[model samples]
Target: MDNLALIESFGDFKDEKGISKIDLMAIIEDSLKTLLRKRYDSDDHFDVIVNPDKGDFQIFLNKMIVEDEMSEDDDLEIELSEAKKIDESFEVGEEYTQEILVSQLGRRSVLTLKQILSTKLQEYNNAALYDEFHDKIGEIVVGEVHHIRNKHVILLDDEGNEFILPKENQIPSDYFKKGESIRSIVESVDFHGSKPQIILSRTSPVFLEKLLELEIPEIQDGTIILKKVVRIPGEKAKIAVDAYDDRIDPVGACVGVKGSRIHGVVRELKNENIDVIQWSKNPEIMVKRALGNVTVNKIEINEETKYALVYTPVEEISRVIGKQGQNIRLATWLSGYEIDVYREKREDDDVNIDEFRDEIEDWVIDEFKKVGLLTARSIVDKDTDVLAKLVDLEDETIDDVKQILKAELDI
Candidate 1:
């Protein structure tokens, strides 16, 4: 290829691909030098000059000027007669400088130079991508769904960098179609070979934290510090927050006015319920808050075992345990304590469901326990229709169970 044509094509590529001019020029120079070394056995006497802006380059070969009869090494020495023809000032024992045309590199060598340049450019791009993502671990990123695989989903960023969202890293309820935009945190970056393997995760606790940061100005600006975050993916999450300024109600700031601030975060998480709790250094107080909307009567902590026993009103027990035990699980994770729930016995009226397991079948008692009704009082407090709706039981069966319990209590 012609010098200007070659330079222009590479310059256009550099601009279109967002490569630095200095880096592109260096690659070009190195490729040309490689071609020279291959053809002449060494590039020690070749100098490559490139003007990226003007898309022009020059290659000069320097040789020692020697007597016409004494020019034994054609690659390292030029005859004075030949040097004087180009410049009469040329003298023996002096260097003769001559411009070498790109066309002189021959068709095969020129093709090899282009191949080398392309390979080097690809390598540089991969290195740059790896560095960029390595610094973004735990930070959020957005990409478009490109391909869905059996184990993961492939996404393309705005710059078309591919990222992997493993099935395990996606929220349980998360569903994305091709061409849909997805937001996730950069879980990790690795390299199998020269390609960057960027992993994204929507199920990470950091993803929830980042979403909170994006939605709540107080958290982002440090007015309210996010102390901790724990999540059950698309089901529920709890975050502990505190602020240096006592006047700033950290929970209020994070939750916003009537959930105006947290609504965005919830939507992004596929309607995951998020509970914002005021942070406390005392584990007892923190565990109480982590239990969310429940009104705890007392908390007993065993610090050595990192365990806690929580007592709440029987009616509030279901709210504490939540659906599928997600609430309590997240609360335990947030507070760093394994918690067991108990009902506060204000009167002798309440009785454990196990007491009636002989009258009620074991499977029947299990159904009630699954809905968080562990006490006879909790079951009786619910209307028969409500209890029937909560469990897979007929209304008449619920009424019969309540009547038997009531007869034992003499209510």
Candidate 2:
């Protein structure tokens, strides 16, 4: 291409990529200077003046005039005989200035200039993308699914910026088709070489936090503060929220009437069950609230070990633990404590070991039965070490047996 065509081509690229004109000019000048150095060995004696708006540039080379045979480097010192051809009065020991046309750079140098400019512009774009997304971490975004792969899904924003939703970062129940609109949080931004990898996550706790902020004006306006969020992705999630004002019920406000406000967030997360609870400074109340809003009869906390033993009514035990123990697991994470649930014993109720024959091993039940610990409560009430000594079983086995008994009897 001619000089003007080349510059105009750069201008077209700049406009298409949404690059600033000043940045494009800087890249162009640097590219040209790089080519000058490659062709002339050094660009120190070259003056490059560029006018990107006018789509043109000027290059002038300066060399000291020397005797024809005495010229050591043609790039820095031109022979006097050659200088005299351009101007007869030209003499040795003086500097000679000559204009270098872009066309004179030849086809190979022009192609090299294009390559350098394209590389620089691409690097600039990647850096800009990284910076923009880095600052936006933990913020939610919606993008169209452009491609789905085994390990990750590629999403494109309105402006066509690519984001990656890795399989591990997606909710367990999440499934997306090409061209589907997906909403997620910008979890992280990193560089794999010069390419910026913008990672989006649908399973992050921050994703739920951001969704709550978007859906609830109380949260967005700072009237309610989201204290913490913990999740099992598509299975269950728990968020602790607090409000400074006594009149405002943070949990009820977030849940809305008949679960109106949080419905959208739940649907977006593939119907992940969310439990919103009021945060409290008292660890016992916090632990009780974290346990899926269950009515705990008692809570014994060991602050140094960050562990708690919660006793709830027998009927509330299943709800406290949830399906597959997800609720209690989330409560443990949210409360910063290792929680063990116990059923509040009643004098009238006791499940015989034979009643748990379906859940406990025959050999395990026989071992407990032999010790006269026929009732499920009898096994649960004893410590692991004491039970192990009485039942001729390992502490782990005794513990497992206790768990099975407790689970079956709703403890």
Candidate 3:
């Protein structure tokens, strides 16, 4: 261990930046300290020292000096004549350095050192990434759209790390232009591959909640609480809000004076529809409200099953069900119940057996054309009650079949 050889073993620490010898000494000392701790189980015996000028590191195993004839375990005995050769005052209890060879370490020990250095470097990188994004959670960050696959939008964040915005987590109608910058809140950070993975999202309910918190001071101040939110991304969202403080109106605060506050959140969601509703402790009231403006005649709930059967006017059925069942689906999700919608039957529109039979019979006869039974008149004229006898149908079934045939034949 000459100084020059030890320094060269560290590769080049100086290039354009030109690191000083002291820096190399510190690095080597720290490296050796970690290596000794990992390699040896002893507590207070081993010590490491680095000399900048010599570019070398030294390891010392502390031992007490003793007389050559002493039988004490605490001392490494040397004759008095031999001790005076090194120094005149070299006492019997003094400690001495014993040079260690790096080559004396086994292959595993070298591997352990390499692993320690790699792990430390990775940890340093991870720490740097954490420092960069720790303060950015819940805040919007812009990322470039790299590619879209399996409904997941792959985005490159500001740090050049790829983040995934799962398709189900993205607003359906929100299209990302290739290479275009998309803005979304940093939903979460996960450490992966020596760096913090930044997860971004636009369709998360938290995004709306955060947007409200930003726009409405009442929410941020803790007066207003978001009770529940149901969203059909890029289509519509229903938010139920309540105020802990009586002085604050949660819905009104979120809606602004004339829809200003909520409109801001909607705009940020790419102009998605937002309905701000006052939260209610009553399940019926909350469910009715969750169904939006659709009028419910009555709500019958099976508590055990958590199912709600809502009766509404026939015209309002479509309203409650929404387009393609979005309304009912959102209502169910928000209300945490299975919902079955029922519409009241009009008085004049009561089902008549003859009319029903006629309608069905007409369909059957029309269908029978493909099977060569084209006319209800021909079927009804049969003597053995052809439908009941031939098809072995019950009386009611035969009668229904006759009516369907007649209706189908327009007879």
Candidate 3 C-alpha lDDT tens digits along 1-411? 343464574454333224466764665666666887766654256677777776666777665566776735432345545667877887776765455555456667666655664455446456656766768777777789999787688899656767767776787777777898887877788876666777778887778777788898888888888888878778888888898877777888888878987777787788888878888877788789889888899998777998989998755665787765778888888887799877576433222223232235545444434444444454555653555455444667557666654443344
State every prediction's TM-score relative to the real structure.
Answer: 0.73, 0.81, 0.61
Instruction: State the lDDT of candidate 1 residue by residue for 136-196, as single tens digits.
Output: 9999999999999989999999998999999999998888899999999999999978788
Give all candidates' CA lDDT scores: 0.87, 0.87, 0.69
lDDT of 3 at 317: 60
Poorest stretch of ten by lDDT in candidate 1: 343-352
Report the lDDT of model 1 for residue 59. Answer: 96
Which tens-of-lDDT digit does each residue in 20-98 have in candidate 2? 7777778788888988888887799999888867757788888999998998887689998999998999989988998
lDDT of 1: 0.87
Q: Top TM-score: which candidate number?
A: 2
Q: What ranges in model 1 sit over 4 Å off?
A: 40-45, 51-55, 62-98, 295-323, 338-411
Q: Model 1: what TM-score?
A: 0.73
TM-score of 3: 0.61
